[model samples]
Each structure stands twice: as structure tokens, then as C-alpha cells.
Target: PQQPFASSTPQSSNPFGTSSQSTTFSNNSTLNSSNFSNTINCNPTNTMNYNPTNMNPSSNFTTNTFNTFTVNYEDPFLLKDITFEKVEKKTAPFSRIVPKPIFSEATMKPLLNLTYRPPRVTQKKKIYTEPSIEEARHLKEIENLVIGFEGKGRIQYIDKISGTELTTSNIEDKITFLKNEVVVSDPPGIGLNKRARVYVEGIFAFSKSQGDFIVGKAEKYPLKAIQERFVYSLKEDPYKKFVDYNYETGLYVYEVNHF
Candidate 1:
């Protein structure tokens, strides 16, 4: 029987799963048919090649890329609010004041009843009044003192010192003071008539909600130093509080509305 001719290359897997071992005996080695097989004819050029990466594209070499990154920032509230110099004006002056708007009684107390001090009357009397003032002016200014009206909470349209309200015939029942005093109920604002140099003798205290206050001496500010300190504190205080910087008027601005 005539044997088929084959090439001298080593055997390897075909791209297809099955292999043809029927040929390619290197060095002219011949194979005898086993059992009842006949000699076969083979072509040398009919061989196949094997590639492991070809089985799965994932096994091939690859490269990965990414995008460049960037970042940005913005101004903060503290920077926009608290600062070394003046802070940005985000709201109107005294805009933070939320009017108490609490209603006053409608009965309308009597206006400045000096008769209330009957037998107890004294030629020498010590008194403390709101929108605080000195003794001589305090007594004389009682009549002109501002009063709270309807819708206004700071002062009653009556003298707080003497417990008085607008008489039925005051004509519009408005306190005659400051900016269209016809019918407005806002209490009169206060500033000193002259320069005041107070000397605080005891503990000093103040607050925005309560206004300028002193305990030991000048009920509002006992010490001239304390007054200076109070004025400077306005710049530092978070509530935006401040005393009158006007040296001529010597005013202390309380947070109260109408004042």
C-alpha cells in the first residue's frame, strides 16, 4: 500500500476544535494503517494554524484612558458677612427688628394724672423713666413725653411715668413728635441734647433687645469708658448694635421700634 506524503512541522491545534492527526509525520516517518484502515491521500498545503487570543477578544492586549479633572470654589457667608472692615449690606438698617406687634389694652388709661401722688408727694423725689433723661428735664419733659398708640408697642399714647394716655380730644390721638406726628403711634426717638460724660461706678451691662443699660451709675451707661466701649462694640457685635457715634447729640440707639 502507498503511504501519503506529509510536512516536517510539529503538530498543533487547528482554529477549529477538531485536529487532523492523519498526516504530517516529520522526517519522512511513515505510519502503518492500524486494523482494517486503507492508505489515505493528503495535501501539504491543507494545514491549519492555532491562536489562543483568537478564541476570545478579551484576551488581547488593550489600553484604558481617563479624562482630566478640575475644581472651583465660591465666596462664603462669613466672608460676605463678618470681615476686618465693613461687612456687605445684605439687608436694610434695623431690618432685623421684628415688630413685637403685641396689642395694647383698648381701655385707654388716663393721661398724666399728677394727682396720683397724693399725700406721698415730696418736693424731692427720685424717678426713673423710659427713654431715660435727667431730673430737671425729666420733670419738665413729662408733658412732651411720647406715648404709645394703637399698633405701637414701645410707648403707650400715654406717659409711662405718670400713667397717662391721649385724651379723647388730643386731635388724632397721636404723639406730637418726629416725622408726620399726626396719627403715627411710633414712640419718639431719643438723643442727648448736649454732650454727656458718664462715669460708671458699678457693673455695666447692655443688650440689643433691651438697649443701652448700666447698673451701678448712669442707668444706661455709667462710665464714659463704657460708653466708648459700647460704641465700638457695634462694629464687633453680630446683631449690628451700636450707640450714637454723634458726639454732639450723645444718643444711645435702642433696638426698640418708634424710638
Candidate 2:
């Protein structure tokens, strides 16, 4: 060869030679094409290492850093799905109650006076005679009335015209006679802006033993005062009963309804 290539074989006692072993030793540490490209891409400082002979010498050789940041061959186990359960609510017994209808200005119209009256002869002779009898019977009736309402209380007397209290001495005789007279009413008035004319004939306590209440301490024989817890009962009409006189208004009020 023209100027034979350098070899490791001795050359006329010259020290330098280019044998295969010597040639390979210098190239072994040099990067292949693929290694040079990867180095250049990953580090700008190593760009000088990207020589033409260094890029992918064989297709089978792949760098470890090649797919680390990409999804091209990522592990399938990293993908996951989460699930959760839904709960239903339970209701309590008697949770719903029907409300009763409320009667008020907003819900219903105001009610008018509801009175019951029987036909009457405005000018009957008996009416005139009865008033006279009533006046004649006053003193006697007063006594009976006192006896009838005995121990009722002070307020019970306020409703009457005479305003006499039987407890006093002056009205003693009048009070006694009233108790004996009967109670009767010819014309009944049961409504607003009206009046009831009552004629009480006899006094009767529903339970006679009930009278024992007024006789309290009578056994003591102290000749002392006694108080009777009296419960007066009377029917105002065929339909309803009025138990007693209103201690306040003195107006006849309905009794406790049995129904």
C-alpha cells in the first residue's frame, strides 16, 4: 500500500502501529449515533457529542430515558376507577297529621245573631193580668226568691230590679216567701238584644242531700252562720239548659253541656 496504514505490528522498529486491537480501543468508548442524539437532546452542553456516526447504529437498541416522560409504553396499572354507595332516607310514623279547618275572618264569614222565639200575642189580656199578679206577688215572691237563691252569693242579686239581699234583716220575710213560690215563664227570649221573662214556681235542688251543704256545722249547734254550695239547674228551652245566673253579667248563661 501507498504509505502502509499504521498498525500495532512492528514497523522497522518504529513504535506506532495500526492493528485491529489498537484501532478498536480508540473507538470503543465513542458514543453510537443514537447515544449521541439522546445526549444532545437531553443536555445542550453535550451537543458537541452528536457526531454523524453516533445516531442509532441499530434499531433494536433503545435508551432508558427514551420513553420515561412519554406515554408510549407506560405501565397499565397506574390507571384506576373509584366507586361509591348511595343511601336512602327512611320516614317516621305519624309524620303527617291532617290539620283541622280553622274558622276565622280569613277563612269564614262572621256569624249573625241566632235566636229562637215562639209566636206571641203582643197584646194579650193575660200579659196585663200577669204583670199585676207579679206585682202583687212581689213581697211574697221576694221571700221565695231569696229562699230559692239562698246562699247563691252577693252577685246573684245584682241582676234583679229590687236589689234586695235576703241576708239583711229588713228583707227576711220577703226572702222566705220567695222560696215557697213556683218558677214559671210565659214568654221565652233566647237571643241577642232580647230578654227572658222567667216565672219560677218551686225550688228544687237536683239532689236533695245536696242541701246538706248549706247546713254545714248545723251539727255544731253553735247557732252560727251556714253556707250552702248551691247548684241551680233550669232548662231555658226544650233544647238547652241554663245552669245558673252569670255571677258577673247576671245574664242567663248556658250550663255545662252534657252532650
Alpha-carbon runs more than 4 Å astray in model 2: 1-52, 56-60, 63-80, 87-259
Clashes of each: 11, 33
Q: What is the TM-score of each candidate against the true structure?
A: 0.15, 0.14
Write the residue-wise lDDT of candidate 1 on 64-114 in tens digits.
546654433465333655557667867755745766556875788888887
Candidate 1: TM-score?
Answer: 0.15
Q: Highest TM-score: which candidate?
A: 1
Model 2: per-residue Cα lDDT over 129-239, one tens digit each:
212333535443231122233222211121222322223332332222232222222122211101222323223322244442222223332222221123223442543
- Model 2: lowest-lDDT 10 consecutive positions: 185-194
